[model samples]
Target: MLLDTFGRQAVDLRVSLTDRCNLRCTYCMPEEGLQWLGRSELLTDEEIVRLVSIAVTDLGVTEVRFTGGEPLLRPGLVAIVAACAELAPRPELSLTSNGIGLARIAAALKAAGLDRVNVSLDTLDPEVFRTLTRRSRHQDVLDGLAAAEAAGLTPVKLNAVLMRGVNDHEAPDLLAWCLAHGYQLRFIEQMPLDAQHGWDRSQMVTAGEILERLGTRFALTPEPSAARGAAPAERWLVDGGPASVGVIASVTRPFCRACDRTRLTADGQVRNCLFATGETDLRTALREGGSDAEIAALWRAAMWGKKAGAGIDDPEFLQPERPMSAIGG
Candidate 1:
């Protein structure tokens, strides 16, 4: 493992295939999306695979996740997954997506060795979904969910962002929907990741409050923390049975101390944390024909300088220049 100065080992890597997304969600990007990186600015599939090889073989990374504005927007997504899966001592592969075009490619993705997926679906109400995402693609998302399950993506995780007056009232209904459909649901507290820099904690619904609302309808017991201590989400078994749910309390309860992941943006920058201000340029070196050793060294140096926490609660914490869409979610 690549150990940092704080004694934290980097064991997970999130690679953004592309910054382009099909949907324009209110919380993620602007109504008129920001200018996207040109095709030449993004990392080629081969370049991405090479980096993943170094992360797994040299740095001892055991898990890799693909994230994007919406990963499905990448035409070469399955091919990318295949390349990563072919790595010697292959790492576990997963993806996070908006699920807009997923229905069309779900089976192909599974055949390419994608182990699992997390689909971001905030509201189940069609009109509410339209209002939040600025698109009427809710049915497409639902179809994608069914397709994923049919394609054998077991325990298909659903990620829902909790906003105060937006979709927080449907917490129970969402949970009910997931439980009935054999989907594992996770509620994440809204963070300062919007392209508009309009995240207001005062208008955010916290993880604790979500749990309170959920508990009123169903019994929940905490899973042993030791089993998933390093994971971002705190999981629980709903009704003490087979069903489960998770709450990512990034705001009220920060898990920075145990964070073991780093991110690579679609534009080829390495970020130690999601909220990192400083970025190490890897694309320039790759395009300039820098050898594997040179690129790997640069990556190690960046990780070595990672801060202990994101410090979202700090008074001086400024919103990151890139939003979740540009930063790879």
Candidate 2:
């Protein structure tokens, strides 16, 4: 297995299929949604498959994740999932989505070989959900989750950004709801990906704080799952059933030293660090008639250049200027 500068072995990759999205989550995207990437500039399905093949075979990446401004917005998402699943070794393939249009395509996704789904749902209250995501149909997210479960994506995951004063109070209630429904709920700390999107350091909630809150209500015990890559989330199983929770400590606590994953943007740029300004333009390489081996060399440079840590966790470190939409989350 190929390991990056940090001790992390390269096992997982999150590929952003499109820069376009259906919902304008105020935190990730501007209210007026940013400009979408031109069709000609995005990575072709063949190019994406080649890159993933190199990653899995050459770099020993064991898992590939499909993401985007909302990965479901991409037209050939199911095909992309199918292609990734066809990898000889068959690394774990999954997709993360906002779930706006998930109800229509959940079954097709399962049929296409998507192993799991992570739906972004922040609030239970409709009005508050509208305020956070700036979208109606708060229940649509729940419906999407139900559809995914019915389509055999059992124990569907729900990813919630635990912002202070917004949905922190609902942590216990959210856990209870997930327990009843048998969904794995993960709470992520809001990173400083977009400085202008009203991200306040004071409003941030850390993983330690989240564990404390859960411990107050349930007998939360830490699990010994392999910390394979840049996934900062330390997981725990709640007292009773198969339900569990994960804490992604992006801020207040950083996992820079053990960071492993690499991200490919919809526009075909390899971003080693989410907060880094530098990007190797693979679209240029592809367009300039670069061969597969040539493009693979450039990818190697990008991997070797992965930064120490995302600047969000350290107050002394300068934060990333790029918004979350431009970079895969």
Candidate 3:
């Protein structure tokens, strides 16, 4: 197990396939975008599979989530997912994407052993979508979601970040659409992970405000805390039973104490936390002919030094140099 000093074991691993995205979401990166990672810098398909295999067979990682600037942009995604699925003690596989090209590959991914998906869809309005993403691909995302459902990706999840004035009022509408469409909706508090570093605390819509907006449309009953386990989202039953909604208040309601996740960048760097400033380079070790046991030990050491919290509430908090796009959502 990847055990930290704080007694949290990392059973969940987030792997970034590439630092390239098709859309330019305003909250994640600038319109022009940051310098893309060189092809030679990214881990090869074989390297990714080997590391993930080690994490599952050697280490105790039980869940593997493929993330990216947009994972669908990776040319070898289906093959990677298929390889990872063949590992002993196979991990539950999922992906986090912008859903730009998901419509075309949703079936392929499902057939390749992908268990589910979490696609970012901030608003239902085409105009709002175009304004936020700086692209007119709103219909593509909707089609992608429908494709995911048709492909049997159970409980297809939608991740939405609510900005203060922009699309904040659409909270209720977003929830209604999710409930009606059988998709799990999670509203996240915008964090200081943008490449522009223009995040303002006051300008973010808090979890309280989100629930308050949602209250006007649907009656929500809080799920028991005991049932939440290590999941980041705090869920509530919509109208008393069955369907539900969730809030990932990473800024307002930190769940650091119960965090069970570890991250790997596209370059094969181990990130202990989402806001971590330091990284453990496993790629170099892998390229240098290090044994699997040696690489696993290095990963274990990195997680052991994870900070107690993200420190977003600290007086001297600093945003990570790498934006969410590079860091993998």
For TM-score, the strongest prediction is: 3
Instruction: Encode model 1's per-residue lDDT on 1-329: one tens digit a residue.
Output: 67789999989999998888888888888888889999999898888988889889888899999999788888789999999999989899999998888899999999999999999999999999988989999999999999999999766999998667778899999999999998999999999999889999888898889999999899999998996868999988898976789999988899988989888999899999999999999999998999888988998999999988899999999889999888886
Note each model's CA RMSD in angstroms.
1.0, 2.1, 0.6
The parts of candidate 2 lying over 4 Å away from their true place are: 195-197, 225-230, 240-242, 313-316
Tell me which residue pairs clash in candidate 2.
none
Worst 10 residues of 3 by lDDT: 25-34
CA shift of 242, model 3, Å: 0.8
Q: After the best TM-score superposition of candidate 3, give how far the Cα of residue 195 lies from its true spot, in angstroms.
A: 0.2
lDDT of 2: 0.80
Q: Which candidate do you rate higher for TM-score, 2 or 3?
A: 3
Model 3: per-residue Cα lDDT at residue 131: 90
The TM-score values for the models, in the order shown, are 0.98, 0.92, 0.99
* lDDT (Cα, tens digit) per residue for candidate 2, span 181-239: 88888998887776265677787887878888888899886776564245677788789
lDDT of all predictions: 0.90, 0.80, 0.94
